[model samples]
Target: PCPQHRERALARQARLTKPPGSLGRLEGVAVELAALQASDRPDLDAVAITVFAADHGVCAEGVSAFPQAVTGQMIANFVTGGAAISVLARHLDARLEVVNLGTVAPPPVSDGVVDETIAPGTDNLAVRPAMSPEQLDAALAAGDRAAARAAEAGARLFVGGEMGIGNTTSASAVACALLGKPARSLTGPGTGLDRYGVGRKVAVIERALRRHADPRDPLQALASVGGFEIAALAGAFIGAAARGLVVLVDGFIVTVAALAAVRLRPELRPWLVFSHQSAEPGHVRLLQTLEAEPLLCLDLRLGEGSGAALAVPLLRQACALHNEMATFEDAGVQDRS
Candidate 1:
């Protein structure tokens, strides 16, 4: 973040008609965006939402209530303007795209989806590493390419989304490995799983954790337990930070990706603005670990970047208040003395 711009923003805020810190977190959001964009007036006029879809081998363990085919179907839904993110993107007029990282079967039609398949899916993480080092590199590169696309499109904000069955399991295992937490503490019902299913999911993650014990770094942890889309999201977050784009992180799965990216590159923390606290139980722990205060907590578990997209308007409003509000002198009002 640019300290000079931040100072300028703070001074501008103090001069606004309202009292100091009257606007609450909105004031802070504006200043942070100013610092991130290195502009006295930061705006999120151009937002890009990229949803990376893939299947997870961990689905074989019955971790998700939905079938693995749903991942590919959802990829089609995203491109065809039938998914939640698609509608949200339309509502926000944001540039939306989906990347097919890897699924069991290719979507029936992918007219607009970016193809970045690493494999059919990751290996079953419960018994072995989720992905090979080379596959992980490929996923990260795919994310970098997405960032390049967003930058090319003149996007000021980047929102990364993921669509993968059993991804919560992957994310939970990754978080457990990174945070050194137990699976039972980090795991939660995914895809509307019942209590029994949640228990099974926890046990599956525990096995994966034991199998890939003591990951030395974020990349290792990601490769050990992260899904293709999860890795891609991490890569995209890192890439967005490199390009100086403010990243709006989504729910639990996306937060896990952000966690890995932040662990891999500590400086990326400032570039990330978390969107919400998810219904998933592990999200709070991830947020706490990252020291992120999200914009909302609507019990949203949808993973199509919908949560982040929902927060865009709030950030835009912050920028608007910062850039357009009248100062005390401009309004011919007495100064606070």
Candidate 2:
């Protein structure tokens, strides 16, 4: 039933005023959207971005050069409309909402900010689980709530991003667990870590993966090393897809979250549109596992939905070509060869 609508949409698209296969993947995207909405005409009216911010106690393990406090500060930056994501969201006409899924500091109040903290921050996964099962459940629930709110606010497209100092470590660990790969393969320079810093990060992730390696139980693996923001992003992906909203995935961290979401609900995979391939080494492995081909490969490692936000214009253009361009029949042109 879910894919049926998409199949019908593709059929209708082939019959549209254009020659078959002329628009390439753009035509595919339009057909996919039409099927997703169960309508011939699919319009991306509004976009909503949820930037989930959390803190990682694993930062104490010297995995990151930056302190944990930076997570909360960046959330403030997002709220003050000065962060990269803020600029991108404004430019893309997206409604950006910063959610405090769990930050290490006392919550700061700001306009366009939601206090959805599950706790101050996750525990240091280097020694123990990042969050308890109950805390993880609550964080996931918060994501579902956020998605519901975004849908209510007229968001037909969703972009997920995250902010946490040592989250790349957590993301690498999660990627390893989900992909059954060694930590070294998925680890990358997060937040501008140098060669030595990258080595430290890889060591930290290897230790975490060895400490908890149960591919059969992804949720447990996630709880072991994943941040609250990543868990919430997974939930957001599920909620958006279940509601038939197009979910645009960002860089390494967001891809990790999306992978976890797919593990939880395999059916949600169709609603995903990979935005770009990150410079992070682990991103390609994750993409291969998901069998996803991203629209861009700009070597972007920046998180905060910047990559996905950048790809939105291209997706819009795809829709424009599908809907606005005159077909061969409409233009009275003969198709030859």
Candidate 3:
């Protein structure tokens, strides 16, 4: 965190017309940006949003409401600019890069799709490691390379999104491994799973967690119980911090990835800004684990960086208030403090 920029922002905020701390989280958002950018004021002109699409073998275990084929279909939908995130990206005028990490049915080469297929899909974590070590390394590299490209394009903020069927199941299992919790506690109804389906998902997660009992090893936990997209999201967060880019994390699944990344590099915590609280049952626990105070609480469950993209305007408003609001002297008003 930029200590000097934080102090300067606080001092400047005191001189503004509003009462101290009136802006609530908005004020905090401004301070966080100032610290990240190492400036008294911050802006988000060049932002990059990357949506990583993949499939989870756990879908074979009847964990997800949607079939695995939807993974590749959604990637095609994204490329054609029809998905929710696609519209949001265009509305924000942000660069949207869709990566085909490893879908069950890989899309043909086309616009807006980056080919980084590591495998057709991960092995079912219920019975084996989701990915081999080599595949894990390759997924991380894909995410790292994606973030580097964003940085090279002059993106000051990187909003990492993901699309994968049965990913919530995988993320819950990873959380169970990392946090030493029961699968039942972390499992939720993903993609319209009913209570019975949720119970089945829990059982599958329990199986994966039982296989990999070492919570001390984050990478092992991820490889044992994570999906390709989740691993890439973790890698992207690390890479963004490496490039000094401010990261705005999305919903439950993305936050799960960030948690793993934070466990890997605790120093990356300050560079992260959680966008919103997802309605997914386990998201609250993940956010609490990160000690993150999200900027919005719309109960968003959409995972395609929609929550994060929606909050960008709020960040812009925070910056506008911090940078454009006049001081007491400018307005010829008496200082309250």
Off by over 4 Å in 2: 1-20, 107-109, 213-215
lDDT of 2: 0.85
Q: Rank the candidates by lDDT, best first.
A: 1, 3, 2
lDDT of 1 by residue, 29-134 (tens): 9999999999999999999999998888988898888988888889999988989999999999999989998899889888998999889889999998999999
Q: Per-residue lDDT for 1-337 in model 3, tens only?
A: 7899999998898889888899988998898899899987798878899999889998889988777788888898998988999999999999999988888887654566999989998999999999988888888889899999999999989999999998999989888888989998888886688989998998898878778757548899888989898999999999999999999999999999999999998999999999999899999999998999888899788799999999999998999999999998899888664
Question: After superposition, which runs of candidate 3 have C-alpha atoms over 4 Å from their true positions?
Answer: none
Which residue pairs collide, candidate 3?
A: none
Pairs that collide in candidate 1 are none
RMSD of 1: 0.9
- Score residue 157 of candidate 2 by CA lDDT: 90
Q: Quote the positional error of residue 301 for candidate 2 in Å.
A: 1.0
TM-score for each predicted model, relative to the true structure: 0.98, 0.94, 0.98
Better of 1 and 3 by TM-score: 1
Query: TM-score of predicted model 3?
Result: 0.98
Tens digits of per-residue lDDT for model 2, 137-241 = 988888888888889898989999998989999999888888778878888888788998888888888777777757547698779889999999998999998
